[model samples]
Structure formats: structure tokens, C-alpha cells
Target: MPKLQGFEFWKTTLQEARYVVAPMVDQSELAWRLLCRRHGAQLCYTPMFHAQVFVRDANYRRENLYAEVCPEDRPLITQFCANDPEVFVQAGLLAQDHCDAIDLNLGCPQMIAKRGHYGVFLQDEWELLEKMVKLAHEKLSVPVTCKIRVFQDVERTVRFAQMLEKAGCQLLTVHGRTKDQKGAFTGMADWEHIKAVRKAVSIPVFANGNIHHLTDVEQCIQETGVHGVMSAEGNLHNPALFEGSSPPVWEMAEEYLEVVQQHPPCTLSFVRAHLFKLWHHTLQIHQDLREELAKVKSLEGLSEVSRQLRLRCQEEIAKEKEGAEERPRGDLPFPHWMCQPYVRPPPKVLVPNGQSQGSEETKTESHKRALEDSDGTPDSLSKNKQKKKARNPHKTFCLELKPKYMKCEQCGNPKGSKCVFDLCRACCKKKAYKEVADCPSHGLRFKTKADRQRVEEERAGAIGDQEPPDGSQGLPETHNTEQEVH
Candidate 1:
């Protein structure tokens, strides 16, 4: 195994901080970090940042990079996602002053990551990964680290761990799941593989995944002999896991709310997610309350929900003390809240006819023209023609037998290409794509109210400002009409 610089520094750091908070994309922000620290998380990592965006857009850095650490928040690591070594160096330089270490996000298995040529998709590019790490190690003042998922083969996974260390990764975090084993199939993390990697590498290794409870931390350390254990969903559900069995959801949620209120404000969506995770158990038994919580869009709204849950918890504990029966737990087969598969909307229904009443291509063109025209008016004649063209509604809709398991649904990879992350062959042709761009514009990708508002204003402004090309009455003929596969 290649020896990395600053291993000694991390060795001491890990010795003192055996319980870590994984760098979750939106979940591990300042408020969550502070909560984890209060519950005995020795070290914390910020949400992953895009190196290209961090270096190019000052506005993005200002909006997205919101660590807001204090003296007590030491031993924090800032993770960056990057495909280019130079961009990684630039991003690291900007972040080194605030964080104890710089971590490379090598484990993200989302299709967006693969399309952008970063995260797990870059796993095959050994030399490039090495060079990026080496550049950060040599150029940055702080130590460099990497968080990676294991491969299908244990030998390759072990070699990958060692290669990261050899390339100047002072600390390594190993997530036990393979890149393809996400969502419903996330199953148990392979501790045996983690043990093999820990044995092969001299640097500190942090084991992530399957850390459902506090006891699981000790069990993982005993089995894998890793320097530390990190948790994302588990911690979100019970930020107090590093300490012991969680108190009530209300207690933790209330504490987090207070902490965030004292610091700079966080996005309402983030606050909602944390509160929902903390209350997953309570909500499972209270379907009506869950609907109200789901609609929460402000910290004030969250506080109101927290107030109710806190009172409910208190009431339940009092009832138990008075000999009242305890409420039954959720009957869901999945033990932990994280085990549930991410919910996806039902697929779009095809037009009733076997073929589209009007060609989809023609409709796309008509829509483009509607947007370009000064009046932005719908053509009444075209609508009438389409309505007249409609034939038997019963014959229009088509259904095909859906596969129980699909390797890639986005670009529709062949059955043999069992890669997950929702990637398809179509995306493989693209040179670059933004991972988070495909998400709903109003989702958690925006960190704060101001961030989302700014985006909305910009989007509206751009649309209104657009002008037709010289000598042309409509948008460019080459305007892309096909939807993003993912």
C-alpha cells in the first residue's frame, strides 16, 4: 500500500473522534453538523460541493458553501466533487481555511454523477483520481481524504482503498455497498469487504452504512477494525445515536430547530427533511399528522409541528408512567427508515391512440413558436385539427410488460449492462451533464429561501429576455425537444 502524508495527523484525529457524521448532500449542513456534534460525533463533514461551480461561480460558493463553523466545530471536513485536477485544487484552496481536511466524493451512485464524469463513475479512471488527490495533498494546507463505495470484487476494492492511500489520501471512508446496490437493494453493507480493505491500508478507515443504531457502531468497529463509523440516514433519524438509543423525535427536532435558529437560517426543505426523519416512527402511526408535516414550508411551521410532537411525546411518556399501554411500532418490513425505497412518480401514460394524434415532434415545434410569438397566443386552428384527428381513445393507450429488474432505465442500457443509478445508454453519449439540474426546480437542491427565489427570478428573467434570432420568427430549429432521460 502506498503511504500518504499526514497519516499521523489523521491517526490522532481518528483516535479522538471514533463516531463521525457522513457528508450527506443536503442533510449534513451546519445545523445537522451542530446537532451531531452535541450528540458525540467527534468529526463532521459538510455537504459535497461541485468543484467546477465552486471555482467558477462566486454566487454559487456564497449560496452553497455555508459551513459557518466555530472553534468547537473543529475536525470538520469539506467534501468536493470534481472531474478535473486543476478545478479540485482551486476548490480545495478556497475551502482549506475553514475545514480540517478536504474530502473527495467518490461514492455518489446517482445517474447525474455518472453523466458528469465524477463521483463513482470516475472509479475506472485510476490515474485521474490519483492525480487529483496528489494535487490536493501537495497544494492544500489541510489533509486530503476520500469516501468511496466498494466494487463487486473484494480484491479490486482492497486495491482501490490502497491506491487512494498511495495517492495521498490520509483518511479513507469506505461505504460497503457497491455502486449498483442502491435504493431497494441497498441491503446490508459487506463488513467482510470493509475488514479486508482496513487490513490492507495503513491509513485510518471509516466504515459507513448499516449503522442503524448506536450499538451498530460498536459492532461495526469490532468486526471491521475501522478507525471510525459514519452514519447518514441513521443519524438523521437519531442524531443522538453516537450517545445511545434516541430520546423522542420531538426532543431532537426541537434541539436542531433551536441550534439552526441561532445560526444563519437554513432552507425550509432541509429543516422539514430532518424533522421528518426524526419523527419517522411517530409519523408512521399518525397518518393525518404526517400529511400536515409534509406540507410544512417554513421554520415557523416546523416549530409548530415540533411543539405538537414534543407535547405528544411528553403525554405518551406520562401515560406509560401511569400504566397506559405503549403504542405499537410501525409494521413496515424495513427495520430502519432509510431502508425504504425512494418514492418515484408513476410513469407517464401514453396517448390513447397507438400513435400520437399529432407528431410529438410537430407539437414541440408548435410549443416553441407559441413561446416566441409576441402575443404568446395558442393557435386555435391547430388545436381544432388535433382534436379532429383523435380516433378511438380505447385503442390509443398502449401498455408493455415492464421488467421486474432493469439495469438502466434512463438511456435503456441492455439487460446485460446491470449498472444501477438509473443510467441508460443514451446518457453515455453526452460529454457532460449537471447532476442536480434534473431535479424539480423547487426541491431541496436549493439550500435556502433566498437561493430558490433568486433562481426563480433568474429563470423568469431569462425567459422574458429571450429574443428571436435575426430574420427568424421562432426559436432556433436545433432547440432540443427530447426530455432528459433521468
Candidate 2:
């Protein structure tokens, strides 16, 4: 069965569209999504929600689920998951009235999901997933869609997509990682797998995962050849990465700055979070630049820093232009960070399906800490390193570390120059690994492994605080039973 509004939904979705940012829970909140919408995000999804609580808790409705939605934020979808058709149908009926469409979460791969029986676990039971889809389509007038990941085996993924199509899901998004890889070791998103899903169904298909720039979008299209492309970390890096066509780098950054500045009362924490991701993920090379910019704490500070950085970017662009004018070279030599090998994170082997994604508060805190400190590398580069840059064709040069910040390499000194590798000596002695994993999207390595640990801890705690599903209960202790949304 085709979606009742299938034509309208998909038609308007990518009419002048080049991208749809992936629905990452913490990263894809209304504020970030709106920033993207202003840029080039033609369509996007609210972070996933459990249908049970959406119906049971008014607080969940007002606060977590529908917090930043406004009229301008049209063409948005609220994704929901449920075990019982009746429950989700009730929730979808309500959600469809508010959102342009509603989606089912059939692709989450966390442990909480398996135990809670949602997300990627649904792939295990085709019959149940099909029923959930049919019920949602039958119960709601707005378009019904689902997001999925390619199973480890390609044919299984194809069969699953067919089932979803049969159940009347009008549009589908396929993230390339399977339930098995769990986003570990840079799960190379299998674009070919997404193409297979596209081939299996007639509905518009969007490709997702690891896209960081407009160039990446073009690469994915050239590779997958899908109807549309979606990115979480990519859009997070450059809000204006998507338009009817590829956007210029500085233009994307300028548009984002404009959007953030329009909201004066917004917190420094919020502003920094977006800026940090934009620089680290979207642009490559220049770690000194990335680390320095990562610390600006105020609006004025952002402006001053922007003045200096914009000059640097302009100079680099000019250098490249001159090179092209003189010869056939197109751009400046690519910087160190992108070409250099980077860090890693513990594999998210088992996502607890019931785990909460994260909160604005959590996002704010992570941003605050990431910036508010001096990390590793010397305050000044040694003469030898400078000479090497002037001489070597390809060399891996380390940034100098200020003694104050480079106290040790285990626990990074927050007060010191982005002191990294947990150089706190204390952390070095207690180090789980030699280095810290950088941002998956940005490739900006952490000053210390401790920061990485903190990210994981906070995410776990945030999951604990998740507003529980009705009967698929979650952390009772973490729940703010006293603090209801409404």
C-alpha cells in the first residue's frame, strides 16, 4: 500500500533538496535541525521516541519529544517505535497532526533496544515489524516511514526493505552499519548495501552515515547513486552542506553563524557546541587552529577568534589560488590531521535499546568541557619542527606542548594547552589506552583519554535518565519522577 500522502511527502522533501541530516538523538535536536533547515536541510527527523511514553506522559510530550518544533520547522518527522500496534497508532494519530510525518525506529542497535525489543532488534522478527508498519499506515493519514540498517548479510536486508515497502512505509532511510559492527572501527557505511535496499523497494531511499561535507555527499551519490543522501555528523559539521546543489565552505559557515547570532539569549554552551563540531568535523588539518577555536566561551570571543581564523582561511585559499594561477595545482597542501592516523573509541557492541540518547544539558556540558581548557602540544613549536615543515614533502610533525598543560600524557590538563593523552600523569598511570579517540565526524583527537571516558559515562547516565516507555520500564532511580514535563 502506498502512503496516502506519499507523493506530497517525498515530492516536497527533496524537490530542491540535496540532503537530509540523519536523526541522531543528541546531535539532531530541534535547535541543530533548525540550523540545518535554514541552510539546506530539506527534510529531517526528530530524535527517535518510544510510542508508549509519548502517550502515557504529557511531560515527555512537552519537553523531550516536541521541545523546539515551530511552524518554520516544517517538513519534519517525529520517529516512534512500539511493540503493540494499537499503542503506536494512537500516538501516531496525535504525532501526525503536529509533525509533517511519523517514522518507525526499526534500526537502533543498542542493548537496551534488544532487551526493550526495539531498534535493530526488530530486524530479527519480520512478522512483528510488518504488522507495526501496517498498523501505523492504517492508523495515520500523514506519510509513514521507517529507518533501517543493512544487516550483515545483504539479502536479509533486501528482504527486510521489501517487507517495509509491503507494509506501506512510503519512504525509507538506510544507515549502512549493521547491528553487528555497532559503529566500531569506523564501520565503513556500505553504500552498495543501501543501493540494494533502494533496488528492493520503489519508494524514495536516502543514504546515511559518516558524511562530513558537500564533497562527501557528492561522493556518496556517485558511489550509492541513491535518490538522496543524509548525514548526522556531516551536517553537524557544516549546517549549510546541503542545498539544491553543493554549497561553498565559507558560505555554509557564515549562514550558521548568522543563525546562532539571531538568538542572543542562547547560552554560550550551545553556540560553542555547534562551532566546535563545524570546525573539527567539516574542515580538515590545522589542529592548532581547531584546538584554539575550540576554547572560545562567549559571543564576543567567537567573533574575535573568527576574525583571526577567517584571515588564515583566506590566506590559505589565496595561496591555493596563486598556485593554480602559476601552475596546474588546485588547492593548498592538505593539512596534517586528515592524512594522519587518528584515535578510536570502545565499540558500541550492544546498545541498550531503552537507553536515552542525551539532553540539551548534556550537550551543553560536553561542549563546555571540551573548550574550557588548554590541552596537549607545546605552547610554541620547536625550531626543528618548523624547519621540517619547510623541508619535508610529507612529514608527521607534533605540535609543541606547554609545560603547564603538558604536565603528563594520561589525564589532560584542562588549564594547559589542550593537554592531551590524559597527560595529567595521574591518568597516564591509570591509562586504559595510550591515546584518546577523536570526534568521529571531525577527526579532532582529544587532549586526553579522560575526555573520551567522560563522553561515554555521561551518555550512559543520560540513557539512565531516559523517560521510560510505559511497560518497557527503564532506570527508575534516574527518572525525575518528581520533575514531570507538563
Which segments of model 2 are wrong by more than 4 Å? 1-8, 12-18, 64-67, 243-272, 281-486
| Candidate with maximal lDDT | 1
lDDT of 1 by residue, 1-486 (tens): 233254576665444578999988888888889888898899999898999999988877776664375677778899999999999999999888877788999999998898888899889899999999988888988889999999999999999988888988988999999998665445668998899999999888899988877788999999999888998877877788888755656667778999889877688888888878777766766677777887777788879977886677677778878999865545533332222322222234333444657532211011122322333223422444334335432321112422454555454554324322334434532311333233222122323545678899999988767855563557567866564343
Q: Candidate 1's error at 423, in angstroms? A: 31
- Looking at model 1, residue 94 earns an lDDT score of 88
lDDT of model number 2: 0.66
In candidate 1, which residue ranges exceed 4 Å CA deviation? 1-6, 11-15, 316-325, 330-486
**Prediction-by-prediction clash tally:** 4, 46
Model 1: worst 10 consecutive residues (lDDT sum): 360-369
Candidate 1 is scored at a TM of 0.67
